[model samples]
Target: MTTGRAAQARRAADALRQRIVAGEFANGRLPDEQALGRSLDTSRNVVREALNLLRDENLVTRRRGIGTLVTAHTYRHGLDRLAGLAEELTPYGTVSNEVREARVVPHAPPAITRRLDIPERSEAVYIERLRWLDGGPLSLDSTWLAPDIGHPLLHRDLAGRDLFALIEEVTGAALGSAEVTVHAVTAEPDTARVLDVAYGAALFAIDRLTRLPDGRPVDVESLRVRADRFALRAVLPRS
Candidate 1:
């Protein structure tokens, strides 16, 4: 059970969290505790409690002389939520895409054959793209889709476009939950060349296979993101 003071602190924290997410505060700086307490109709101690919670969440920093400052540097991806990459990243900064490889091929890689339920040497669309945030490389996404499923995308302009949105709009399929697996791997020669990282630099490999509402499999995505540029956060309740 939460005490009244704790509950009040949570409410204050929730309000500030929304404003920070909306980019209302300039340079991620929150006002002084006294000002925040007055605005929220709470006491200074309550405001401090709220700021402490946000600090624990990695959303702000509170120093004695410096007051409170927001320190949200990397994108915070919620593990319990499902959203398009654009929606996930747009809040941080401008997003752009560079389509590296977009074409229908006659062969499906052996690894994805079992996942896509296609035989070896089956037709598939292979798309390799680099995602940029504020003109800097952020992630490298390699996607393989069933040929008939993804060939239609070739006609559309893919540069600077959202992959999940394009697929949903074209296929009219309600994308369901994604089965994601995360791994920490060192960049290979090819990955290093594309991501502009050292040959053996650290990277995070995120593999996702999405399904439709009706249980139909779609594309398989292998995303290699700079480890320092991204993070995953989850809120777990006591069982």
Candidate 2:
């Protein structure tokens, strides 16, 4: 038989799990135990017990030095469907966008020019942005668009708007398909600054090249996300 205090703690743990799954508390941040206790009208010990329950479930992990951290959860999307960033993060919370830099600049490196099929000296629209969940930076996105089709993109307000939708609107081109690669990389200085992590923190880097209906590559994007903040998951048909 469970005591009333134990039962209360169990209830609190369940509520906290629901809130996390519902995206009330975001990644890389932990909820305050005292505050949670106050909100739940329980004692600190009860809250601690509740947190212990969550820890056992593997939904959260206790670092040796750092406090508890919410482990990355898997997100599933349909194979044939494309969802905007905002839509994809809707389950987490209200996603916000900050346009750090948006300008037309001369191509700098062969990495971008080679993919976009543009000359080294050609100008391309360079867009840098930081995505936030619950007002905290979660990912840094950098993209280069070819000069021929990117000039019109320079004159738009992209805040709170999906880049893919904006591209379709400005160029009248539908996104047919995209090739993407995912890898883990140590965060660089700029990426660390935008993501609010240590200089050498582990990050998930996604490189993607998207094409229009006619197979013309329109954009090349590199996305850097904090390993603790964002996660990618896929489901496959069983053999």
Candidate 3:
């Protein structure tokens, strides 16, 4: 049998989640427990439990005596399919570009070397950009491609272009699959400057390695996005 407090907690949590999705609560605002409890006709204990659920999901945070605040949404992409930056930002009407630093660079990092299967100290094309949404900075992206497959890319106009499409067109390498990982991070000074946010601001960092149909590594992209602007959702297959 379900206890009254547990039921109340579930109801309050669901109600609060709906309110958040509906934009009624507004981001970063802290509503008092008493007010939330009254709104849901429940006790403060139930409200607290509900808020704790949100905090666990990375949707909210509680400070010492500062109440609970809404955190930004983080987007998650499936490992089964490959997507471009533009496609990822479509829902938000976010605009992005290949910054001036998008060029071939030598001596790739160890992580990049391993992902792209390149020799240590090998040259690679480095693409850098600042993504914007409704004219506001959204993310800072840096991608590395093996020189053997990236040299020809330099001849093309990449500004405001999608790197994935460019790779397909140039190499005729159809994207088959990708491995991606997402994590929370604090922005560094350079990343902060490009994203137009303060240093140490919360960020959602994504690291992805894409492969061709034959399983050859094609590109490795590192994406750093503002925690507040992006949200990730997924539908899983039940076995």
Query: What's the number of clashes in each of the models?
Result: 0, 0, 4
Candidate 2 displacement at residue 164 in angstroms: 0.5
Instruction: Show pairs that collide, candidate 3.
Output: 74-232, 75-231, 75-232, 76-232
Worst 10 residues of 2 by lDDT: 72-81
Candidate 1 lDDT over residue span 142-239, tens digit each: 99887767988887767767778778888887677789998999889988888777788778898999877777678899999875457676788999
TM-score of candidate 1 to 2 decimals: 0.68
**Cand. 3 Cα-lDDT:** 0.77
- State model 1's lDDT: 0.81
> In model 1, which regions exceed 4 Å deviation?
1-72
Among the numbered candidates, top lDDT falls to 1
* Models sorted by lDDT, best on top: 1, 3, 2
Error of 3 at 182 (Å): 0.6
**Candidate 3 residue-wise lDDT, 33-78, digit = tens:** 9999888888999999999877765568899878888765434333
- Which residue pairs in candidate 1 collide? none
lDDT values for all models: 0.81, 0.76, 0.77
lDDT of 2 by residue, 2-90 (tens): 47978988999988776765556666456677888898888888988888887765457767667767765523323335555566777
Overall local distance difference test of candidate 2: 0.76
- The C-alpha RMSD of each candidate to the native structure, in angstroms, is 7.7, 8.8, 5.7
